[model samples]
Target: MTTDSTRRTPLVRLRSDGAVDEATLAYARTKIDAVLARPGLPAVTGEVRITRAAAHHAGHPWAATADVRVGRRQVVAVAEEATGTELVDRLQDRLRRQTDKAAHYWDDGRGTTAPPWRGGELRDGVSP
Candidate 1:
């Protein structure tokens, strides 16, 4: 992700196996932008991919993974629910926590930094 700070914030990339629609994508962007707008948070850029999991999950039928590039760092957040609820409600809560954690490494001292890409990997789904 590019981090000029002056450039336009990159659009969130919504990816699905033909399971999500334009409305859902729009809503996701709204909710995500709202979360990143919190005070003292870093300016974020990148894409969010939402995929429909095979019919075996619970809570939400959709699963989302965000690849955010803050300043020079990239941070990824992933969540899934077997049902359709507030995308931000089920996902942003956890994502917010992650942003908070990564904020500790910010260079601006005000938690204003970019998310790290780290080779395009999802931070939530990888096995340790």
Candidate 2:
């Protein structure tokens, strides 16, 4: 097991809409590390942006967006949850799936088609 100092740091940004506690940030970093540990993701550097809804909500109000670079490909996922911990967990789940697909597409020659909104360029380039 590698210590925090040994792992590549993830760039995390807490949106100005709301503040995120230190504990939550630490937890998110750990989750990112776990996601990067999977096979075929030898070198990953990415960013995680977490935002909390400004208004009070009855349901999930926190959102997390992750952009991870695995090899020559990138994997992105977004998730929302009622609590900070839940938000992190959901983001981790999404990252795992996205990373798997990216790895398969780049390493295993599998035709893994990403979601329409996964890549930022793809999303920006599309016109309705």
TM-score of each candidate structure, all chains considered together: 0.60, 0.67
- Per-residue lDDT of 72-110 in model 1, one digit per residue for the tens? 567888887754455546777766777777665767754
lDDT of 2: 0.70
Error of 2 at 51 (Å): 0.9
- The TM-score obtained by model 2 is 0.67
| Local distance difference test values of all predictions, in order | 0.61, 0.70
Worst 10 residues of 1 by lDDT: 1-10
How far off is residue 46 in model 2, in Å? 2.1
Poorest lDDT segment (10 consecutive residues) of candidate 2: 1-10
